[model samples]
Target: MKTDQSLRTVIVTRYILPLREGGSLPALTEADDDFKYVLKFRGAGHGVKMLISELIGGELARFLGLKIPELVFANLDENFGRTEADEEIQDLLKASTGLNLAMHFLSGAINFDPSVMKVDAETASKIVWLDTFLTNIDRTFRNTNMLIWNRELWLIDFGASLYFHHSWDGWEEKAKTPFLMIKDHVLLDKATELRKIDLEFKSKITPEILSSIINLIPDDWLHWRDTELSPEEIRTVYFEFLKIRLENSEIFVKAAEDARL
Candidate 1:
């Protein structure tokens, strides 16, 4: 996770606008550091589990040398958005008055359209490998949850990654499952070097990296309200799921390779 101390405690200073484009209605907000961010609320949709996915998937991508906006642990106060005219947004802010996830907004970034912007084979293959490993099924051509900034590809919106977390059951089995969704991936055709990229990435997801990423999820986000598992147990579940995913990578790697054919 991007645990730079400045990111440790960013208080949301002002609400700028509601990004209604997303189902969760993530907001454009300014922080104490005077920087604008796209804030993902903990109280929205899938709630904290979404944030957890964002953290792990994004940090894992960064570790593997993919470009992503800096993610910060944003703090929101109870009355932060009370003055907003929209009642729905007001209630959302009130409910999300604690820890949340935010990405440094990429000003002037354009949505990535493959027709307009071409990606190299290696980069496309790595992204295919990353999404397949992360189980992110949202990167189809329709959505293409990727952006272009300064002529570089920057990944965004990992909330859809780690889909298995939605149920919080059968996690171990889910980890080793084949990610058959790669066939619909926007870059799958361009990802010609899937096997090579898999070899380069499989060993990079070490236990230490897994532990470091899982440990970054906060206790509040770790709470599974429907389950009796404590935060520590929940953290262990995350670590174990990812550890097994790393060990059993061949399943998804082959799935991606076959999908390209």
Candidate 2:
């Protein structure tokens, strides 16, 4: 959407380096481009899941008021034969939004490791809160998915979130509170500041973005249900909850005080 201002569509050059740890393969785009992005393909018969996962992940990060890079759904014209599992997703977004939309290319943005920086407890607290709200269980010591850009922390690789959706019971747990990040939490000691964060950012969570995300959800993304919660419903729930939390940070503070007493 912001591509017209920030980025131009260019052919990716080649897979320069492979970040094999997280199933991400990094590549170089045409030489003139200033940014480099990662290309993630869909799994078998599960194109819908991949797209929805990105959409939900990005949207939730934005909703939580984090400094996340802009993400666009792209269509890679290069063909993998029909036997590949993600062919369905590849065909769908390509036809719908044209080939090659823009996305949050992480490499040019930040370093994946935070052990090298100096971050404090409060900032780490907010990071843990985001993980709890999204039910993301992957931000462990071994496989941290944080990207540091321009002295700020940006979140990435949320494929492991909403894990219960894939389970037989479906996503039944409501994400109400933020999680706690321990010393073992990656990026804890990194010298990252908690600036530019808008606890009140819920007000800016536009209807258009929410609609765009919901509209793109395919019919077969694992256990995601096309339930009664409309786009507006989801938007309202998120906004109201976020507003309450921001306006009432004191509520949590008081609870902590009472616990101490």
Q: Evaluated with TM-score, which candidate comes out highest?
A: 1
lDDT of 2 at 64: 59
- Window of ten residues with lowest summed lDDT in model 2: 1-10
Q: Assess the local accuracy of residue 203 in candidate 2 as a C-alpha lDDT between 0 and 100.
A: 46
Worst 10 contiguous positions by lDDT, candidate 1: 1-10
lDDT tens digits, residue span 1-261, model 1? 333323356999999999998989999999999999999999899999899999998888888999999999999998788789998998899889899999999999999998889999999999999999889988989999899999999999889988887787789899999999889999999999987887888767777778788888888887776788988888888889877887898999899889888
| Model 2 TM-score on a 0 to 1 scale | 0.55
Q: How accurate locally, in lDDT, is each candidate?
A: 0.89, 0.46
